[model samples]
Every structure is written in structure tokens, then in C-alpha cells.
Target: MADIESEQAAAAAGSGALVLFSGGQDSSTCLAWALERFGTVETLGFDYGQRHRVELECRDALRQGLTDLNAGWAARLGPDHTVNLAALGEISNTALTRDVAIAMSEGGLPNTFVPGRNLIFLTFAATLAYRRGLKHIVAGMCETDYSGYPDCRDDTIKALQVALNLGMDRRFVLHTPLMWIDKAETWALTARLGGEPLVALIREQSHSCYLGDRSHHHEWGFGCGTCPACQLRAEGYRRFVAAAV
Candidate 1:
């Protein structure tokens, strides 16, 4: 394939975008989408000392795939910048970073909700983009099918965008690709943007399981199927598969 879509995206964007990539299903899809839509895409990751660090391990392969898809990416793409936020581990007591149990209490947010994660992440991405003179930041945050994270809401992101712009005195637009769609629609979008091959690649390679155990595989990545992340991903994959059939 010519990867014409990526070229068109680059032209349309007129420059590059900074993507908050986590090497998970959502962020990987966003990375591929950004490469296809923006002139170039810079990937930024965080190492907040999550117990399941396999997510970060996948970043390199995903970035390499972008180059394979479009030779131009070898130049246009920015090196993956992963920051170590070990301090976050010291401050938060979530299931992601701690040995604590993942639980949801009667409509309340789950124990997996890392406090202020997206806010801090996007802020870091914006600061990095500002330094590089790029004005667009891409996040794969979704309101639907979200894991009850307050920070993932549209209002929170929009508010942060304004705050970052005001704080930095620069115009920055945060783009959320999977904001309104649920997990099933996310799969549909991956198929649309990168075709069946990309979809398959994500299914087999991307890591979304909170448990971080790639040892046991499922149709929807390497999730344990008991955790919230696994449950949601599996359900979404089921919906997408049924619809395809």
C-alpha cells in the first residue's frame, strides 16, 4: 500500500502532533491514526511505575511499525520520549501501581482510577509540544466505555486544554479520536484507518490488561479477563466480532 492516507493527514495537519501513547489498544490506534492524519506525530509515554510495565515495552515495536507503514515516517516522526514519573507511584494508591486489589464500590470510581493521570499526562505532552512549537496534542481518551475515570471526560480535557493554553500563553488544541465512541467503535475505527492487518496486529500485540499478564492470551489482547480493563476490552471485541459476522 502507498500509505496515501498518512500523506494526506500530514498535508492536512501541516505539521506534527504530539500523541500521549501508552502502547495499549487505544493509544496504539491513535498513533496509527495520527500518523495517517498529521504531517508527523511525536509519541510521548509515561513510566509512572505501573506494575504492569509491559505497556511501555510495546512502544518501540509500535513506533517501528509506523516507519514500516510509511517510509516518510523515518524522518517526520519524533523519537519516542518516555518520562519516568516514579514520583506518581509514591503519591497514588491505585491498583495500577500498587499491590492493592482492584475494586468498584457501588457506582463509585474503581480502584484502578489513577488520580489525575490524564491531566498530568496531557500537561506534560503540551509542555513538550510547546517547547517543540507544535500546537496539537492527540489523546485517545474516550467518554463511552471508559473505566469510570473522571479525568477521561470531555469536560476535563477541554478544561485542561484551556488551562494549558492560558498557562503557557500558546494556542493548543487537544484532539481526542475515541472520545465519544465505545470500545467496539474503536475497533471499527482501527479497521477503517489501517485496515484488517492493523486490526489484527493490535489484537495480538497491544496490551490493555490491567493485570499486565501477556502469558495468557485472549481474542482481545493479553488481558486476564477478570480485571476491569480486560472485561471491557473483551466485551468490546465481542461486539465488534458479532457485528462483523
Candidate 2:
């Protein structure tokens, strides 16, 4: 398999894109989608000193898969561009950071919610794109199923786009392929872009669990299957698989 950098490099040929990849199902799917669409894709993964290093491991695996998918593409994609932006770490109190109890709060931000994560990530991605002279940055943020997150909202992304363009003195396109799609639709999209084998690889290899539990059933990826993310993923998978049959 191609490494993240390699796969992205394959995608990054003449028409390039920068993707905010997290080695999770949604982001992996987006990565694959970027490869198919842009031909030249660059990946940016952040290391905020999360307690779980498995995310990075999976990221590496995804990158490798990308490389294996198209070695020539990987070669063209260029090196993996990753950053250890732990500055955003201190601002987040989510379970993704500290050892505090992980629970989904009611009617407000969930404990799994990291403060300004997407904003920070997209900002970094945009900055990198600006430096590389690429104007397109892709993320997998969803509004249909995850409308609770303020950052994932379409208004928020559009605002951020405006801010980034103004701040950088350049225009950039923020691509959110999954923004309007629910999980089931997202799965269908992945299957369409990457094939059934790739979608299966995503379902089995990607990590979506906030708890970092790797023993969950096959329905969801790694992590406790009872969490909101896992439940939603499982539901989406069920819907997709049933529909396919």
C-alpha cells in the first residue's frame, strides 16, 4: 500500500488538493475521493499529542494504501506533509486529549468535541495550500448527521473560507464532500469512488471510536461500539449493506 504522502502525491499531479486526513473512516474516504478527483492530492495529518497514537498508525496505513493503489500516483503526489501542531492541544479538553471520563453531553458540546479543532486544522491546511500554491482543501465534515458541531456547519465553513482568503490574501476552495451526506450516503459515496474492497478496507481499518477501544464489532471500526460515533457508523453501515443487497 502507498503511504499517505505517496497516495496524496499520486493525487497531486498537475491538479492538486490538500486534504485534512485523520485516518478515520470519513477522512480516509475523502482521501480516496480526492485521489480520484484531483489526480494530485496532498495530505495533512495533525499530531496534537493525543494519548492514542493509533490514529497515526492508521494514517500511515492509509497512506501506504494510497501508495499501493497507484505507485505512480504516489510518486507524483510528493512527500507526506504532516505537522505536530500541539498548540491546539491545550485548548481542547476532550477525551481525545486528557484522561478524563469520556461521555456525550446533552444538548451541548460533547466531551468528545475538541474546541476549534476543525477550524485549527482547516486553517493549517489552508496555510499549507497557500504555501504550495494550491487553492483546494478537502475535509470530511458532515452537517446532515453531525450538525451539532458548529465548525461542521456549512455557514461556519463558508465563513472560514472567507476568513482564510482574506487572511492569506488569496482565494481557496474548501471541499466538503460529505457535508450534505448522511453516513449511509457517505458509505455509498466511498463505495462509488473507491470500490467495495476499498470501502471494506475503510470499514475495517479506519478508527472512528472516541474511546480508542479496538475490540468493537466489525460494524464500526476501532473503539467502543456504543458511543455516538460508533452507533452512527454502525447504523450507516447497516443501511448501506442492506441497500446494496
Candidate 3:
């Protein structure tokens, strides 16, 4: 088993990686993480008709910003692809896909939880990776300090990895660097990866608010500050800053 795992890792390292970048802090950090490790790195985004579709707009700038931060990153960064998963929005009636209120559902999960979102996302990403001859799929899905999205759990990702490999007959490795880290650690990670310039780029450009608001700018970033995404990011930034002080 160890040897097989080593073989898989070796194969993945050679074939480059595809990062599921959402123009959010976590995904941006994950992109940098992939660039640091992989020889070739590409990005993929989904147009799921999300409320914060504005995030899609930030993707290009974020990619270019990362390139400008490091010459090596610019050389390794490859083409980006965006898929139109608008049907997801048409089928899901939730806060993320619709204009509904952001609250906990009676079932306990947040309304922002889009059913089978990560599952579908990974499946699509694996399909693209296969087409692009990329054996590694990197995502920013996190269980720690998240909004209780079941799909973001490590178990879900691992299970999906197996399913994707079997379904595609390809050994595609799913990399989730943020699976076990909180938002504070996530901020620190960007700092470690690209220093203050990358941190400032993420703070100024990345969009995490569910309401799609970019008018308000806080020390952490731009958001309404009341939404779960903004609150988590803001509190995490506070903790990260306090720890450094």
C-alpha cells in the first residue's frame, strides 16, 4: 500500500495540478500552495449562478496578482477554465444560489449549503483534469471554521477521490491543503507563501460575502461584515493579527 501510494503521488506530481479557485481567500491560498509544489498549475471556476457571482470577476485579477507576486508562479501558472454550472442554481433554492435569507435550516445545516455541491464540483474538476492530462485536483474545501457544510468534510473529499478514480479509471489525487486549518491559519498561510503583498492582494480583491457586496472595505477585506463569510474572515484576521503582535 505504501509503494502504491508513493507511485500515485509521483504520478500526480509530474502531471501538474488543477486548482478549484473561487476568488475567495481559501481558494487563493490553495492556488498559491499548488503553485509552490506543482511544476504546472491551472485553475478552474464554476458559474453556478451564485449570489456572489462577483467572485468570478475577481478570478482573473487574482491570478495575475499571484503572477506579479512571484516570477516563478507566473511561469508555472497555466490556463484557467470556467464551467457554466448554472443548472445548479436553477435546481437549488438556497441562500447561495438564491436570494433567500442566510440561516440554519431545520435540518441543522445552513441554507447556504448547496446540495452535492462539492461532489459535483470534484467530479467536474476530475473530468477536466483528465482532459487536460492533470492528475492532481486541488480545492480549498475546509471543515475547520466553516459554515457546517457537510460536503467540505475530509471524509467527503476522500470518498470522492476514490469514486473519481474508479469512475474515470485514472488515479487523480485531490489536494485539500485547507481541510484541517482554520481561517486564521489560512491568512497566515498566504503570508508564508507570498508575504504581505499576496496578503494585501487577497484582502483587497478576494470576495467572500454571500450578498455580493464590495462597497464596504474592512481591515480583513471587502464584505458586508455581517454575513457568515465576512464574519469568519474578519474574526480570523483579528486572531491572525493578534497572534503576530
Name the best candidate (by lDDT).
3
| Residue pairs in candidate 3 whose N, alpha carbon or C atoms collide under 3 angstroms | none
TM-score, per-candidate, Cα-based: 0.92, 0.87, 0.95
Clashing pairs in 1: 9-37, 10-38, 10-39
Writing each residue's lDDT as its tens digit, candidate 2 over 71-183 gives 56476454468888787777777777888776767756777777788899999898889888786899999999872878899999999999999998987989998999999
- Candidate 1 lDDT over 106-131, as tens digits, reads 56988888898898899889989988
**Which parts of model 2 are misplaced by more than 4 Å?**
1-13, 70-76, 104-107
RMSD of every prediction: 3.6, 5.8, 2.7
For candidate 2, the 10 contiguous residues with the lowest summed lDDT are: 70-79
- Give the clash total for candidate 2: 23
- Reference-based lDDT, residue 91, model 2: 74
For candidate 3, report its TM-score: 0.95
lDDT of 3 by residue, 36-123 (tens): 8888999999999999999999999999999999999999899999999999989999999988889999999889999989999999
Q: Lowest lDDT 10-mer window, candidate 3? A: 6-15
